[model samples]
Target: MGSCEVYPQTIQHSPNGRFVVVCGDGEYIIYTAMALRNKSYGSAQEFVWAHDSSQYAIREGNSVVKIFKNFKEKKTFKPGFGADCIFGGFLLGVRSNSGLAFYGWETSDLIRRVEILPKHIFWSDSGELVCIATEESFFVLRFLMERVTTAQESREMLTEDGIEDAFEVLGEVQEVVKTGLWVGDCFIYTSSVNRLNYYVGGEIITIAHLDRTMYLLGYIPKDDRLYLGDKELNIISYSLLLSVLEYETAVMRKDFNTADRVLPTIPLEQRTRPLSVMLFKNNCLISVLLNYLTRLSILLQFSGEQIV
Candidate 1:
């Protein structure tokens, strides 16, 4: 195996397991774990792997973060006063000294900023919720990207002519619980010092209290279980059916936006099943039909259509 002499303080493997990042020696090094191909960046403080692991950003300074694609630097930006870490998705999550902020990954536009400094930050696999943990509390920030009217459309009355241009909107946040990892729709965490706690549909439940502290490693959607590590270095697994049920209920309630954000996290086999595929397709069709119906109704009313 090919290895570097430097010890890494922060390391992350890409979601696809094709690449790995090592942060140390005042540089960020990226290399394929199974091969010898690698690249490095100097004067970097922190870095984040995109969900697909194909892109990344390195913190060059307190305010500046440089993004890279395919091992090449693409763009740089000064996010704000205290931006430290970067999390990639439809938008970029920049962690600063004051709080977290969102920015357009491509346009380099500032979207929204939240003022909450956290000790630990974990973005769900689906990128739907950002789980932040502090010594005294925990927070879950939910985000959605929707199309909206552009500024140009608002100003050009003559050009508008009943047609409006649209742009992506970074959504708002909702605090679900004091602490925990958001697995699917459920929040899982260690509470009361040593007990495993989870919340589903606004209800809090304690699964067990351990003699020692346990850390949540990650979630496995295929088995609907959580992989955890204990202080003594023991690994444990726990089921979260309630959380899965919560997600399904959201879909049944026609909360397709949330459902769409979470759909990527489901197992591929399940997502490809005939019934699952049909359900998702139907959801999309319903949204399109409803939108056209709304436009048709408005047009008919303005055209003076008569009721029979």
Candidate 2:
């Protein structure tokens, strides 16, 4: 299928590569890759595909971001101003003029907000890291999920005061960086002149300079590869050094669920790192303790007994 529009502003393949999304002429089109059959979804200023490609979201106008599941409109909410919104795993990132806000895609719950407008934003495939670039610096934010016992508690947690208890800034680079992607603990990005650079362990390393300007399109954590698009419309993939940093970071933050999801992606040898092993054991112990405490508290409450 084809559109009568002169050209499409952007074209993207779903994570599973089963479908293609084309945006142009104020419409977003979805096409099946095999037969090339297509459908238009009307007007959208911007759109983003979920990491698994099971759903997608579109920035409608300036204030609202609408999510679609199974190609149907699922939910809509105001994520402040600006049309920059992205999704990875269960988290959604939106850029407002005031700051960058992260939300739980399923619940529409605000997770955290950073008081800065980033030039570029990228969420790690596992949703453990959020890497952002600004004119003067680069930053990474990390978060953990906690079990909330009540709807009231969850509501309180979404408030600005409680957001600090859920997320933290992992690191920042005091240098001007362009498009970037997070790979484990390292951040790979390009400079204004299209110079490839990597930041790890507080050090920035320049890798190479490309002949033409390029933008980071996406990253495949499973394959440890980055997809880049250049001005000439050429797309290229480059292999990157894989690390278990995402898993370790998640475990360190006590986000076992996310860590568990990332664990299988890591090489077995890397999984045995001392910190990883220790954190795993500690997390298990904490889980058991919390469970016991919860049960004891409930029993006491039901028995109407007072503790000394």
Candidate 3:
């Protein structure tokens, strides 16, 4: 096989057989289970790759850590100003800004400690000891290691001006009233002054007028579905873009005009209130927390027999 060339601004690999490389400009590569199963490329902006590559992690400014047989990106163990190191099946991490934060592969949540250790660090698949540096020399240890083989995939082409056509809308959005528009698995969710609308397949179907009572808080898309969470702890789940209007009317016909109040929710007491939505386990809906917040959050899973 021809050796693949990757211009990763930052690169990392784990001994367990997984790879995570991020372009300095803002692109990421992940070796996922499905990518390995089909022997294809797995690099979607969304964290929907299949589990089995041995390590689960992503690199933004900070890394989101996940470990499981199945690829569910929700088990982000440590967030915020800290470092991590893993070796011999033992995962370790340190926290900061106030509190003890430590964890491993066994526990779903992280534990905090009183003292900090400088030597306990995680190793990468290349047998290289890697640690995040704050200034020029002081290294904070964080990040477990895994190994993964990569198959080159087509990437977005950028123009000479260092811009992509996809991001052009951002300029237009800023011209407006700072409105937000997002694409979901099955529909599009948008927010403007006092109004929330849902569109499926390019057609407007559902409309909610907040009337200055409440503001739109967040939305999450997953597996051809979208979950909307508002400021009032109301979580409304919608599937199939064409079905959004019908679903909302049926669920809130009695109080559609008034602000949402009686909706069920995934617990968010331990973490900061979510201002945005992200895809969780099995394409389920969940709120996105700040990268460094100490909160109680878990990947919401679907229990249907059809789920893989």
Candidate 4:
């Protein structure tokens, strides 16, 4: 048709650029490589594109989980309780009012379910343990190895151990705004501790940005870089290079922690500035700089070749 109608939720091009996925408040629409359209699900609280881009998952507020492959229904999971879900590889982590649960793809079976105060959940690459977050708390849960042998099995696992109060309750957990979570070789989330914090995880590391005006946008695990944009139109990148203990102590969780700098720059000095930034590859940064006042967009490319 005529340039495919723009969506209100959010539209994202797959990393490979073969497909485009749109997320409405409670729905997701998938457009194929050739621009074929498919209606996936409805009443979803959130949506995540699979790493391979072959399928995507929807987290329904009613605790009904669904996944579609090639625009066909692959599987459906119902937690039996209202829960929020996050995905990694073939694993799905679901957060509920009572606790958290994990499930495997293909087979709609439970991996592990913990009955405790639930918050946010993150599964490492290995998928052995998961990090859970609450108001101002964080905890880890280890999966029983013997249970999750494969998807063909029953797919039930036990929780080994977890923390009740993971970190020191600093800032107002209610006032703390959660943008999103980044997972890979490192983890960076837009969360406010005392102010706004950029958490870098890997080899036990975490970094917090004290500036209230700054917000974390994205993270590239391969390069260990985090992209931050401020209301002042300053786009900066922070590369992870130190350990978490180097800034905070094991006994006390301090928000006044600072890691070493990587590289900081503004993508758009003119116009109203870039509303978004994407890391394509080394030296080549893709930015969608906007001038709302004039209602224009300029795709800016920042590279070393042009600097000289």
Residues 1-308 of candidate 3 have per-residue lDDT tens digits of 12233355544333334444333344444433224222222342222112234434432233344444334444555455443332222334443444334444444333223333332232322322232222112121222222111111123332222112211110011111122333321223333454454422222333555544333333443343445555676766444332332323223223322212212122233122121221122122222222212122222343232211
Q: Can you write out model 2's per-residue Cα lDDT over 246-288, one digit (the tens) per residue?
A: 6545655567677655555554344443433455455554552
TM-score of each: 0.65, 0.66, 0.26, 0.54
Per-residue lDDT over 1-308 for candidate 1, one digit per residue giving the tens place of the 0 to 100 score: 87765688988777788877888876777777788477555568788866666677788767788877777888988875567666655456787777766665555556566565665665665665566665566665555433222432344421212112222222222332333566665567776467777644334456676777677787776677777786689999876543344545455446766655554344433433332433454464455235434544675677574322
Model 3 scores worst on lDDT over the 10 consecutive residues at: 167-176
C-alpha lDDT (0 to 100) for residue 106 of candidate 2: 67
Each prediction's whole-model lDDT (CA): 0.60, 0.66, 0.32, 0.48
Model 2 misplaced regions, further than 4 Å: 1-6, 80-90, 147-156, 160-162, 215-229, 233-308
- Report the candidate with higher TM-score, 2 versus 4: 2
Q: What is the lDDT of residue 157 in candidate 2?
A: 48
lDDT, residue 151, model 1: 37
Error of 1 at 106 (Å): 1.5
Query: Model 2 TM-score?
Result: 0.66
Q: How much lDDT does candidate 4 score?
A: 0.48
lDDT, candidate 4, at 142: 48
Q: What are the candidates' C-alpha RMSDs? A: 12.9, 12.9, 22.2, 14.2
